[model samples]
Target: MINENVSIALVHYPAMDKEGKLIVTSFTTMDLHDIARPARAYEVRSFYIVQPIDAQRLVIKRQIDYWLSEEGRAANPTRYEIVQLVRLKYTLEEVVEDIERERGKKPILVGTDARKYHKTIGYAELKREIEDREREFLIVFGTGYGLPPDLMRTFEYILEPVYGAGDWNHLSVRNAVAIILDRLFSKNRC
Candidate 1:
């Protein structure tokens, strides 16, 4: 994919079959399951793109600082190999590119704005980039702040951004997720 906006680290090859369309990098509305596992109250969303994202600055935290992963002594076993924690650290395109080098083959993506990782809605652009893979969506969210504005953009016809409650201007990934699940599973049909 030779997007003029793509990071310089990723080779801009013309070989990519799809281009010119919006490549979403966040979770889709269809991915909202009913928390079937129940082992964890909240599964921090992990962002992924099908195509190679030039996210050299996306600092993907490999450690878990949360109470469960850190201090908790309880048996937090998982049947699906759920990660202990998934954290996000946004930075300049250059920084995200660095992340790409650090996390090879693990899937690195690019960004456009810096909205502080607001919500999954902002991750639309990230999701579109890799929708064809048909993998499950687990968007690791930002801790202190939220995703930046540049990260969020709806996918093309193949997959568009999943919009939930709250306006785009001010929405948290956790809140967006809560709203999404509520609307998706809400039985109240008046």
Candidate 2:
């Protein structure tokens, strides 16, 4: 079984650039639509969009509010429901505080990256841990080239990278979010 207490955080800043320099990344409209829909479908407790910049945070809030408003709901009821699951926070710390407030304790911070750095727990182990321990988790997805090593070091656990037969490992943050959520929460698990 999977845990319904799990949540997600899509980070926008302190990501890596092509040259591996730490930088702030902009959010795409597709990212807002794609990630939130799955988060709701998976029955996640909450979906957080963490942006350090005020303008970018406003953009995310507007998108979430618009999709959750009456007009947007009338246009697309399903998407509206999904957008309601989203929250826009200015920093990861804010997200932590929110989860603590909502769940009465801090969640386990699980970081996700496309590359393997430190020893990462396999998806199966993560799923088992969630089911057996019954603890809330805040799984973070990094944008741009991926989260900086320093940020990765802050996490208690880093999930294994999603890969296929080929050596190539590039995947959009939105797609990665959906894939990871499905693997962690899918009902067909043994």
Candidate 3:
């Protein structure tokens, strides 16, 4: 399973504000649902929501618990299935550790941002690498403005920005995840 070796992390902490200062952004209910839906649809191994704040983490946990409960499942079984793939974590390091523990090796960290880096792997090349399944891959997305430059530099591959016909490149992390997942995992690609 190509996608089984792939995972995603939505980092709320270590994110940049519009001014580019590092900050911990709050997670929204929409992010959980939107990202998890595509992740489950793509058969991603797991969806990680990384937040350092305890209160925020608690709120997210409650939502996850409710969606996975019998009543919640009865209300929306499809949502329950998507919520099952979500894993809450305090930091990105924990996400990596979790994957390392599960796979017995570290996953190749693939970062996504609106800005282009000096060296970025194209979607086609990454898709081929993912198809080969030589190792696990975890594509990381950031909330707020974006991930900090120092953090972005640490990733093994920062995927090329998803461009549009216009010059504006800003995209919601949820939308970015959906687009990147489609580009990498969709069977029918142009």
Candidate 4:
């Protein structure tokens, strides 16, 4: 399954602030819930949340623990199932290492941003490559002002920025995940 070969990472560190300075952004509970729902729906193999801060990672771990508990399952079985897709990592390198361990091959790194990069690949072209290739893909998303240029350069391909009708390009990482997953995996896409 194509979806099974795809994974996503919501990166909070090495991101840019509004002024374009690199910073670590905090993750919200909503980000976990909203993004996981779509990822599970698409049957993505895994969803990694990358945060360098130990404190933030603990908070996320606690939440995940609850969601996986019997009480949490009783409270919301659907969410319990979805939450299982999430994996916490202290760095993007950790994410790559984990994926490589699980799949026995390094995933093709794809970055996401509101601004286009020189290596930007269109959705259609990316979809074709994903279908044609045998390797797994990890689509990395940045929070705050988006990923820093140095980090962006590490990716093999940066997906074309998602554009609406207007010039405003800012999109919540959760919303972008949902939209990108739909674009890449939806069975009824037009």
Candidate 5:
């Protein structure tokens, strides 16, 4: 788990609405705790919440502060410890920049969507690629309607969709994050 080559970014801006129009979604404090917990459990180097709105950032900062406060820590020290991995960023570019600053090179940005993209890679293959390439990666997940093609196109890798027997495959952002992280890092994969 010491690879230190993997990070996750939950993108709120430049995301699409139900009507397919690009918009910036409001930040949700729930997603912060949910995603950060698993990201920490899986030994992810960092978890970035990418939101552009100033007010939203302030709210997120307050929530983060509360989580780190002595009272908050006393309420649930384990939770506070995991949440300490969360970092707030204004945009995906900033996430990349921070990753580069820490790792000494830009991460291989990867996007995740509910639908398969032309050059998408499977979970198993992606696991191998990460190990073989020995490079840092920033796995990006979008909000509504999933990540648009243009935004997805910027990623060096795209993960294949996770589906079940039925046609329905839409999952909440945090749920998808947990599933994707398990697929990428779970040791039981065979």
Candidate 6:
């Protein structure tokens, strides 16, 4: 079980801006310390190229190993268990395969009105259901433009599309995460 003291984290290779430049030399702590020195906005932002799978695997291995360390293990044993870990690599479609294989049931994928369904799924009700039926629930998502059509069809419900900011979508995943974390902490009276 996870402790109240620790939290889960995920890292991604954020796509580069329209500019061809990937890496900037100004991410050093000293650089941020001297913001008055006048640096381009991009200079403060570090960038990475599309990483290779082997490189990604190496990164995951190193990360999991670090998590398995004494302090880390206490933080999240399930995430970094020394015992067998059921990690399977597959494209978005394989989410169905893995769910059926392990749970003998397919996951409910939702699309369309993402916001409406997200809110409709009462968090408290979900908690009660999970408490009674099972403690674990798996949610999978598609990346890179549109979601997989086959998987989208399998969703039990479609979420309403959300509109925010301006004509174009402006919110980043980090922003969404911060908002969610804030809600969680608020709920826990933290």
lDDT of each: 0.30, 0.87, 0.93, 0.92, 0.88, 0.33
**Whose lDDT is higher: candidate 2's or candidate 4's?**
4
Candidate 6 structure quality by residue, lDDT tens digits, 65-123: 56657776778664344212323232334444554565565544433322344333443
User: How many residue pairs clash per model?
Assistant: 46, 0, 0, 0, 0, 6
Q: Write the per-residue lDDT of candidate 2 for residues 1-190, one digit (tens) a residue.
A: 1345788999987789989999989978898889987888778888898899988878888888888889999999998888877888888999999998988879999999988867698998998888775678899999999999999999999999989789887999998998898898888766
| Candidate topping TM-score | 3
Question: Where does candidate 6 stray beyond 4 Å?
Answer: 1-52, 74-88, 112-138, 144-154, 162-168, 177-190
lDDT of 4 by residue, 126-162 (tens): 9888887588899999999999999899899999998
Model 1 lDDT per residue over 1-190, tens place: 1121222111111111134333324322222222212113333233222223334212122122322253332444441233332222332333344434544422333321223232323333443543443322322232223332233332111112344355454343345444433332234523
lDDT of 3 by residue, 1-190 (tens): 3488899999998999999998999989999999999999888999999999999999999999999999999999999999999999998999999999999889999999999997699999998998888899999999999999999999999999998899898999989999999998887877
Instruction: Name the runs in model 5 displaced over 4 angstroms.
Output: 1-3
> What would the TM-scores of all predictions be?
0.29, 0.94, 0.98, 0.97, 0.95, 0.41
RMSD of 4: 1.0
- Which stretches of candidate 4 lie above 4 Å from their native place? none
Q: Is candidate 1 or candidate 2 better by TM-score?
A: 2
Tell me how candidate 3 scores on lDDT. Answer: 0.93
Whole-model alpha-carbon lDDT for candidate 5 = 0.88
Measured by C-alpha RMSD in angstroms, how accurate is candidate 1? 13.4
Better of 1 and 3 by lDDT: 3
